[model samples]
Target chain A: MKESFSQSMDWLHTWAGLLFGWLLFAIFFTGTLSVFDQEITRWMQPELHRVTPAPLDLDAASRTLNQLAPHADRWVITLPYDRKPVGAIGWQHDGLSTLKAIDSRTGTVIPRRETRGGDFFFRFHYQLLLDQPGIWIVGVSAMAMLAVLVTGIVIHHRIFKDFFTFRPSASFHRSWLDAHNVTGVLVFPFHVMITFTGLVIFWAIYMPAGIQTRYEGDMNAFWAEAELFFEREPANQPAPLVSLADLEREARNHWKDGQTRSIVVEHPGDRHALVHMYRRSDDRLSLDSGRVTFDGAGGALRAVWLNENPAYLTQSVLTGLHFVRFGGSPMRWLYFGMGLAASAMIATGLVLWVVKRQGRHAGADAVGYRLVEGLNVAAVAGLLVATATFFWANRLLLPDLEARDLWELRIFFAAWSLCLGHALLHEFLRDGASLKIWTTQLVLAALLFGLLPILNAFTTESHLFVTLPQGQWHLAAVDLTTLMGGLVLGWTAWRLHHPVRTSARSCHTQPVSSSSGSIGSS
Target chain B: MSLAAFLLSYGGLFALCLAMPKHYRAMCGANALPPRPVLLMTRIAGWLILGLSFVASVDAVGWAFGPVQWVGYLAMSGLVLVFGLPYSPRLVLLLGILAFLAVPLTIILI
Candidate 1:
């Protein structure tokens, strides 16, 4: 009975991993990149790369907004913080709202490139650029990931016996499987924590039955009650507003070291205007919990909202864990490393699925087999090519091009789709075990990433040579990481092109045939 | 302190690997497993050091972020061992010794 149970779990693990593995790879890869979204954004915008972080000047920002839109109703001031040292001001007038970057030291508006920046990777991580539908798709993929992880653990019979087992010099299938197991097992706790937290991040949207039943689907009213949100309608009587610095000081006093991330003035220049100061999430394990509301005209503290509900706080903490918003740089690097390992785990699993069938299913007539083979290449190597192209597009495209951000997105998708075509063509032209498709895509990615610093040197002043000497590690880190990534890719491509043969007879003691047989029989 | 925690976790994991017959044979160039008492000693030392790592992490950061950092440190140390054991067994063992030695050095220096 126990043997049968293990066999069934093996079948389930193989199928579920095969079905959603590609999507999960893309999700995990982009999510890994999203860990350093702010750094990437800094690297993309050359103008703000070296901005001296000065104290936020609210008065100058107010003057700029007043000059731009004297009759504006609402104004927002985004304070400068560590990762992004540029403040921004937006004002609404005549049904149009405009936002511009500002050097907080001078409070003068700066014209920066309008690329989507690292936010593209972040948004794509969860939404796949498909909005609501993409959320559902990613939700399903996360569920599949949970199931695959559980079943994988169950099928790994010698979990403790082979806890530190990894043989990179074994047969192709054996080595890939070992790589998959080592990465998955060594970081098993992180995988489980990250995946489970990811599921709960969108819990309200994914499982909204309670809210629908209790609150009749009135999300605003539900949030108002749950969050203890303070609100007031605009009093149209015109009145001069108090200094925002005073309100920020009051908020700091109340929270005792909490830094304000942004300030929003509702109905500015009115008697009933309200100013809301939100605390940054960088110092806490919960996102957007501490906020102070004030009377805009008098700078009187109206309300302080801190999350106190146990369930809500748990959800927030879980979300924070997945987002890695707290704990500074050491924690960020830890998450970045684990995130890459998770991506590698998924990529190796996908490759193992194809490699296990390589002996019997490497012909054009085996359409389904050939299809998976082609997709394995496209999903793994193709995504890297697309990511490299995205970075290159940031530097290659004209800074002032119309709809520049959308053009970057288009080029990214175009490169990915072209990679898929290349994979399919490469599959049709060969019969078995020819990895020219992988080699070609990886080589292209290597060039794009390895030469990014050179491209930056030609296009902007924030190249590695300049940034490294100036102590701009944020910009230099991107260039150096990409260069290292290029070297790894180039080495991988070389290995793929020049296949190494090692006999599986010397130390092959495990039951590799049993696992493959389960996949075949099922 | 996080570095100390990581080294402790690495040293602890290395001890656990040494307790296992396969890794011991591979890493120590031994044809047979050690005596029963030696294996038990190494296993106990592994768990004990790992527990100290948790304490060190909590002492450095507060209770809120400490355990989180501890988990990350453990995973990182395990990854280093997983790769290091197969590629460079001698270097991995040497690092494990240095990791254990650093604990007292840190306590005295800091």
Candidate 2:
């Protein structure tokens, strides 16, 4: 029998997705969470909880940079934005590199900050637990996913027909298939663009011939030219540097009316040293931005290269688009929504796999079945539990513990591995009460996320309720999210545990309950 | 320690799978064959190669070390050969080339 195009596509989509569903799920979940990365970073640092206007002393900050960076080859200063409490950002480089905040009025050192809240998750999302290679592996998986998407579209003849179809009460497989198709069709453009761009971002590793052949094997040389936005300047000879305040003034002139946001001193205190002040303005090259560079000793106006210029504007635009830096709150919300949809798509695809395979119970007790069952439990419930464990670890970890970053990462992977093992063992035992098992994890998630804020308040004085009204929203946002997530999970658990079938079954069998034991499959 | 532990767990799973009794032919479904043990040598080697590929990613991300520069590539190519004449060798080769070409070009452009 000849399969119709739509049928062919359905077949292609189902099998291809089922083949790598777990990987796709991980990528989508992590990528979606990456949308709120900054907020997470804000929440984790309990010490820097104030939201008040903490602008820095520019004069003193300038003086400090001048004094410390007598021979700094180059430097860039990033002014705090609306998210941070203070414009207290300061930078200086001599033999040492320091990023300190100043008392907006007094210019005192705010020192290096602690707390790895959202940033930890954001970074960990893309770059798995295993260091640099982990990121590449994740990237590879993402690329594979892009292939899956394209192939899926090619095979699906009735894309429009399935666009809005969602039948929740249908058979499990039918429901999962419908939900997956809906996510795939509605955000088709977003899914394609995101995956394509993601692959393009890592093209150099996947295809280096253009560089190796063109640059004649000098990767560094290629990078030197390629990384024009943040040019690496050679160190300069020792010499007195000029005023940073002056550079700021010079940079503002290019903007016509805007303000200065950063300062870069190249080869500070050397014969070849130059100082650059970046004006904060919206231009064609916002990513390739800011201005003002000058000879240090003589104070001659040099070329302005704060990530700007017509030739490299396209890359600047691409970078801006990739990072979503050009837009404000609305764009971030859009990205968040898209991310959630992407995750839902992957989850539905996995569910569809189980539903389809269940119909073919030709060898239900076979090795393949056992393996798939274990994977289903592990990837679905176990992954969530592992992720929750990460938050739990963060809460329990001692603040002053040495190598806390590594320890935090260790907890994530260790917990994940443990879950995978547990899933395999439980699946081997013919566990039929999946709903019961899943409900337990959801309840745990609800409790931990629900109590997180109260715990934060007890453990630290810088609680979000105190921080939010003042303008510091990071901590408040994290707490609010946790509490909300807890409520959602608690509800989900209740629903799963007290499912409609269970209620109906119990009512029907109530009269014979005393005689019958183990009414439902255990 | 991590490497050794991974090997042991993978090895044990391989062994356990192999020892599972294949249902008697009379009891088996008409089309179903008895479950055969997934060979220890094959699973162990496959996993080891996978681990190496993961390590190769380290070199790629860490130093952008010259392409095909990691020790894992040696194990990786060997492992890929294991299915020994996969039905679609040409396609796999093409994909491999594409992946190799794509990663570096993007890095340069980026």
Candidate 3:
């Protein structure tokens, strides 16, 4: 009975992993890149090259905001942090909002070329290129991943014994299995935490039954009561606004960490206008809950909201764990590396599904096998090539072209579709085309990533040489990471092309035929 | 500094894995497992090194932020060990030793 249960779990694990593996890989890949989102944003916008020391001039910032958005009903200023060195001002007029980067030193708008930058990848990770339904799809896939993890653990009874056992010199299928097992085991805690926290992050959307039952499906009322904050109704009586600099100073003085993250002025031209200053939360692992509000006309302190209930705090910490927003560069890099490992885990699992089947079928002309193999290449290598193409499009596209951001996104999809088409065509034309396609796509991705530094040097004023000496580590790191990614991909391609051939009699030899029989019989 | 600690932890884990019979024989070109005392010692030392690395991480980024950072370090270290073990055991061992030595040096220097 126990053996049968384990076999059932093995079946559950295999199907769950294979079904959502591609979507999970895409999510993991983009989510990993999102760790360096701000840095990517910076690299994309080279016009914001000069570093401006902080203690940002709010007086100048307010002046620029007033000039740029005089008729807007509300204005928001996002103060610069280490990653984002330029303050950003956002305004809403007639229900339309616009955001622009500002040089804190000169208080002038930085003419950054229009690019969605890192936000594209961050949003893409959660939304998956679709609109509302993409989120739910991602949520479902995440739940499937949770199942795979649990069942995978159940099936692999020798989890600890094989924790450090990675045999690359073993048979091809054995090596892939070992790689998948080791990656999955080593970061088991992280995988479970990340997936669980990821689900929790979208709890309001995914599990709305509680709110629906309690609040009669009135999300606004639930949020208002849960948040315990009141928004004042706007008075149409016209009045001149008080100096934003004074209100900012007042807000800073109230918080222990005197650093304000953003300032929001609502109904700026009315007597009931209110200004809110949000405190920075990077000093702690929890999300920012510090907010101070003032009457806009007199700059009088009105409300101070700093504390939250335990439930809210738990949610925030979970969000922080998934986001890694509170930590500095080293922490972010660590998250990025873990994310890549998780991606590799998913990729290997997908490949293992195909490889394990290949050995079972041997010489059979199975359409299902061909389809899965083609998809394995398209989902893994194809997605990578698509991402590199996105970066390339960012560099090569004309900066001032109309609807430039949309064009860049279009280019990304177009390239991705072409890759999928190529995979399908190759699979139909020739048997066992996946290996060839994988090698070719990997080499292509390597070239694109490897040449990105050169492209940046030619296209922009600030390249690695300039940014490195100027202490612009964010920009320099992007280039250095790209170069390293290229080298690694190139090496992987080379290794795949020329696999080592030791004698079949290794110390830990397990006959490939017997292994395939066991798998096939199961 | 945290990176150095991370490397040290990975090195320690790799050494401990090398002491395992299956991996040891596969990589070391040996027929017999290391002595029981050696395996026990490596296991204990491995846990100690990992614990020390955690302390180093906490030192770098306080108690509040340390665990998350440690999670990342553990993941990366595991990946490095997985990729490095089969192809270049010697280099992996050499780097592991250097990392083990650097832990104390990092503590003193930084």
Candidate 4:
């Protein structure tokens, strides 16, 4: 009975991991990149490169907004911070919203090129380029991942004993397993935390029972009550508005930490106008720190919400952990590294499934095996190629092209689809020569990433060498990371082409063990 | 300073791992495993070193952010150790020893 349980768990782990592995890989990869979303955005928008950090002048910003969008109902100004040194202003006119980067010193709108930048990856990870249904798909995949992790632990009895074991010199299947297990175990806690917290971050969307029960299916009412302390109703009365500078001063005096992250003004030209000053929570591990609001016309303190309740605080902390927006450079880099490791773990597991199956099946089953092999290559290596192409598109495409942002996204999907086609062609033509496909794709990625720094240098005035000495760490870090990525991918490609002789020998001669067989057959 | 603490923690863990019968043979290129006493002593020292690393990390970041940073360090250390062990055992051991030695230097400098 015990043996049967383990066997069943083994089966469950294998299929659970295999079925959603590709989607999980996409989520993990894009999610990892989203850690540096702002940095990537800054890199993509080169016109914002010249902008420097300075004290926000609300009067000047207001003047700019008035000149650009006088008739807008609402205006939001996001002040420059340490990571992003350029202010951004967004406004809604005729129910249409538009946002643009602003020079913090002059409060002039910086004419930057249109690109989705890191937000593409950020949104794609959750939304998968679709709308509401995409989120449910990602959530389902995450749930499958949770099941896989749990069942994996159950079947692998020697978790601790083999904790530090990674025998790259062992047989092919063994080495892949070792890589998977080592990466998984090394950051096991992170994986669990990330997965669980990711689910919680979308709790309201995934499980609407609480809100449905409490508010009788009225989400707006639920949100209004939940945020009752800061709720405001539009009076729709006509009156002249007070200066935002005065409201900011008043808000600064009210909050203990006087740093303001952003300023929001609603009904800008009306009597019931509201002004909100949100405190920066970058230094602390919380999502919503607090905000102070005032009557826009009279400039009187209206409401203050500090998020002191235990439930709210807990939710903020969980969101903070998932977002890592509170951390500085070192913390962000750490998160990035751990995320990469987690991605590698998923990639290796997916590859291991294909490899283990290939060993058991022979010539008659080779076609099906080859098809899986092609998909494994495309999903793993092809996605990376697509990401590289996205960066390349940002650099290569003309800034003034019509619908430029849409074109960039189109290029990304086109490149990715081409990769899928290439993989299929290779499978049919060469019987799924995985090594050849892997080497080619990796080398292509290496070249694409390796040249990004040079491209940035030629395309823009600021590159790694220039930015590093100028104390522009964010831009420099992006270039440095891309270069390192190129080097790593190049090395991996070289190694794949010419694997160590000892390991290759063992891979061919080693007998198929019972334990290895169970992973595939069970 | 946090980097140094990470190295020290990782070095200590790597040492304890090397003292394991399987890893010891793999590293030392020897047929016989190290005696039980050696393994026990290495394990104890490893725990102590890791505990000290935790303290160092706490001192660097405040109490509120310290534990979170420590977990990041642990994951990073594990990553370094895992990638290093398979490709080049000798290099990993040498780097681990160097990191262990540099902990005191880092402490003095900081």
The model with the greatest DockQ is 3
Q: Estimate each model's TM-score.
A: 0.92, 0.68, 0.93, 0.93
The interface RMSD for candidate 4 is 3.8
**Candidates in descending TM-score order:** 4, 3, 1, 2
For A50-147, candidate 4 gives per-residue lDDT tens digits of 86578788878988987898668899999888777888899998888888887776778888899999999999988898878998999998898888
> In model 3, where do residues sit more than 4 Å from their true spots?
A359-365, A503-522, B1-4, B26-32
The TM-score between candidate 3 and the true structure equals 0.93
Q: How many backbone clashes does candidate 2 have?
A: 37
The residue-by-residue lDDT of candidate 3 on A1-522, one tens digit each, is 998999899998988898899889999999999999989988988778765556577778778888888768899999887788888888999988888987787778877778989989999999887867999999999999999999988887776877676766566788788889888888888889889989998898999998899999888887566664546778888877888878888887878865899999898867888898888887776665578888987877888877477888788788878888787887888788878888989999998988777645534556677777778788888888888888889889998888888888998888788878888788767755667788888898898888899999999889987988888788999889989998999988876766555444355544443332222121
Candidate 3 lDDT, B1-110, residue by residue in tens: 67666876786687677777776775666566778899888878888778877887888878888777777787787778767766666666677777877777877887
In model 4, which runs have C-alpha deviations exceeding 4 angstroms?
A: A229-236, A362-368, A503-522, B29-33
Chain A vs. native, model 3, TM-score = 0.93
Top candidate, metric lDDT: 1
Between the candidate structures 2 and 4, which one is better when assessed by TM-score? 4
Which structure is stronger by DockQ: 1 or 3? 3
Per-residue alpha-carbon lDDT of model 2 for A1-522, expressed as tens digits? 345856766666666677667866776666666667666655555555543455455666656556655434455555666655555443444455545555555555554333454556656666665567876876777776876787777765455543323433333444456567667765666677667666655566666888888998776776556543333455434666666666666666777666666666666567666666666533231454556667766778766555544645555555444455433543455566666667777776775565555535445554565566567656765666666666666666886677665676678778777767766766556554444555666676678778888887777766666656665455676778778878977986785555323122211112211211221122
Write the residue-wise lDDT of candidate 1 on A1-522 in tens digits: 988999889998998998899999999889989999989987888877757788788877877776776567789999988887888898887677777889786678899888778889999999899999999899999999999999989887666678877766555677678779988887888889888899898877889988899999877777777776767777789887788877888888766567888988888888998888888887778875678889888887788877778888888888988999899878988898888889989989988877777657533447787678788889989999999999999998998999898899999999999999889876766643336677889899998889888888999998877988888888888999899999989988886665444423323234343232322211
Better of 1 and 2 by TM-score: 1
Expressed as tens digits, the lDDT of each residue in B31-99 for candidate 2 is 444334434454455456445444544433332221212222322232222111122334333433454
**Ten-residue stretch with the least lDDT total in model 2 chain A:** A507-516
Sort by DockQ, top down from the best:
3, 1, 4, 2
Q: Which ten residues in a row have the lowest lDDT in candidate 3 chain A?
A: A513-522
User: Lowest lDDT 10-mer window, candidate 1 chain A?
Assistant: A513-522
